[model samples]
Target: MAEVLFYHLDRQPLDRVLPGLLEKCLERGWRSVVQLGSEERLEAIDAHLWTWREEGFLPHGTSKDGHAAMQPVWLTAGDDNPNEATVRFVADGAGLPDPAGYQRVVMLFDGNDNDAVDRARAAWKEVKAAGHDTTYWQQSDQGRWERKG
Candidate 1:
């Protein structure tokens, strides 16, 4: 069964929190797919990942970059999983994909944004209703994730 995780981003922005999470996925030898709500946001993230760390690199690619099957991390605004990723990260208020298709589904939302919080709540209900193992995580003041549910 897939595990669905809801990450509440209040202490840090997505750009700051995402790279570390992606690094963890890589460390676990899991391929990832990051689904964004817009093409603009996808492009922005794609660029950000490239320079998120000077000494680190996360192998990722977008549609414009092609070769999806060869990328360890794939970025897209659509539902397709060309890279056959084991984990999916949904951000920027993007619609959730079927959790059954992945080993894990991570939903990251801006806790400071009312709409984002509302959407995350709805997503939590939907995923829970679908019988997926779900957990909610909130960032602490020191930028650490704390399990709240």
Candidate 2:
């Protein structure tokens, strides 16, 4: 079963938290697909990954960039996993992809947004019911991720 990780974002925005998470995936030698809600958001994330830091790069490309299979991190607004990624990052309220195809699934939602939080809650229940190994992580008072459930 795929591991489902829920990230409740309160201490920071997705832009602040995403790059670091993607970096960790790279360190583990895992390819990832970051699925957003729309192409505009996907483009924004694509730009951010390139300039998030002065000396850092995440090695990502969107469908518009072509050669999807060659990218370590593939960005898309759709459900396609052209890179055969072992890890999938579902952001901006995007629905989960086929869990069996991924080793891990990460859903990041804004805790400050009521709708986002509610959606995450529903997702957690659905994932758990689907029999995946699930975990819920929330940001602490000091802006650190803590395993809450």
Candidate 3:
């Protein structure tokens, strides 16, 4: 089963919403992935996450012998996808389970444009249409999120 977390920005940049989201993912046992949008917000939040990593704010179930916490897997589109160190970070984050095998998957999205929102919804729809246990979500401009069963 794959669960999706959809957010309505309410006219805020992703930076304002991302950190709390990453924290939510950590708390809910969902691996985090960021899309290739908002480079400034992405970079700023990445650095902030790094600071959290150094300050012992990482998640539990990390694999390294002396590792402290788990950091979200930063997935930028095309050129800036995570590097080896980030792969290690993902591994440290809940031991990097194979997503294909994950029975419960939760996706967090910054819902701003219809194109992006539609794209995500379409993907999830395809998966659900294919007979997988899934849920889809979209956030409205009125600052309310709607989930599709």
Candidate 4:
């Protein structure tokens, strides 16, 4: 079964939080595909990952980048894992595809957005009912992630 993780975004925006998560994925030797809700989001994330930090960069590419299979992180607005990624990050209200091929699936939802939170709740139930191992993570008062369920 795939591991499904839900991140309730309260303390930080996705741009700040996502790079760190992707970095962790890289450290574990896992390639990743970040699926966003729109083509604009995919483009924005592609640029953000390029210059989010001055000293570091997350090597990634979108569909326009040509070499999809060579990217360590593939960014897309669609359900395509051209990089053969083992992990998938569903952000910005993007709907998840089947998680069978992925080792881990992360759904990051805005905690302040009622619709996003509601979607996350539904997704959590659906994933669990589908027999996947699911966990809920929320930011603590100190802004650190703590698994709540």
Model number with the top TM-score: 4
Clash tally for model 2: 0
Off by over 4 Å in 3: 4-11, 28-42, 48-99, 103-111, 137-149
Off by over 4 Å in 4: none
TM-score: model 3 vs. ground truth: 0.47
Residue 117, model 3, lDDT = 56
Worst 10 residues of 1 by lDDT: 137-146
Model 2 RMSD, rounded to 1 decimal: 0.9
lDDT of each: 0.93, 0.91, 0.43, 0.93
- Which is the winner by lDDT between candidate 1 and candidate 2? 1
What TM-score does model 4 achieve against the real structure?
0.98
lDDT of 2 by residue, 1-149 (tens): 99999999988999999999999999999999999988889988999999999987779998789898899999999999999899999999798776888999999999899988898888889889999999999888898889988
Supply candidate 4's per-residue lDDT for 12: 96
Q: Candidate 3, which ten residues in sequence have the lowest lDDT sum?
A: 87-96
Q: How far is candidate 1 from the true structure (C-alpha RMSD, Å)?
A: 0.8
**Model 4: per-residue lDDT, tens digit, 26-76?**
999899999999999888899999899999889998878879889989998
Q: Model 3, 35-126: lDDT tens per residue?
A: 43444544554555545555564432212222222334544422332322222112111122233443444444445566555655655666
Instruction: Report the C-alpha lDDT of model 1 over 41-133, residue by residue, as the tens digit.
Output: 999999999999999777899989999999999999999899999999999989888899999999999989999999999989998998999
In model 3, pairs of residues that clash are 1-103, 58-69, 58-70, 59-70
lDDT of 4 at 63: 79
Q: What stretches of model 1 exceed 4 Å from their correct place?
A: none
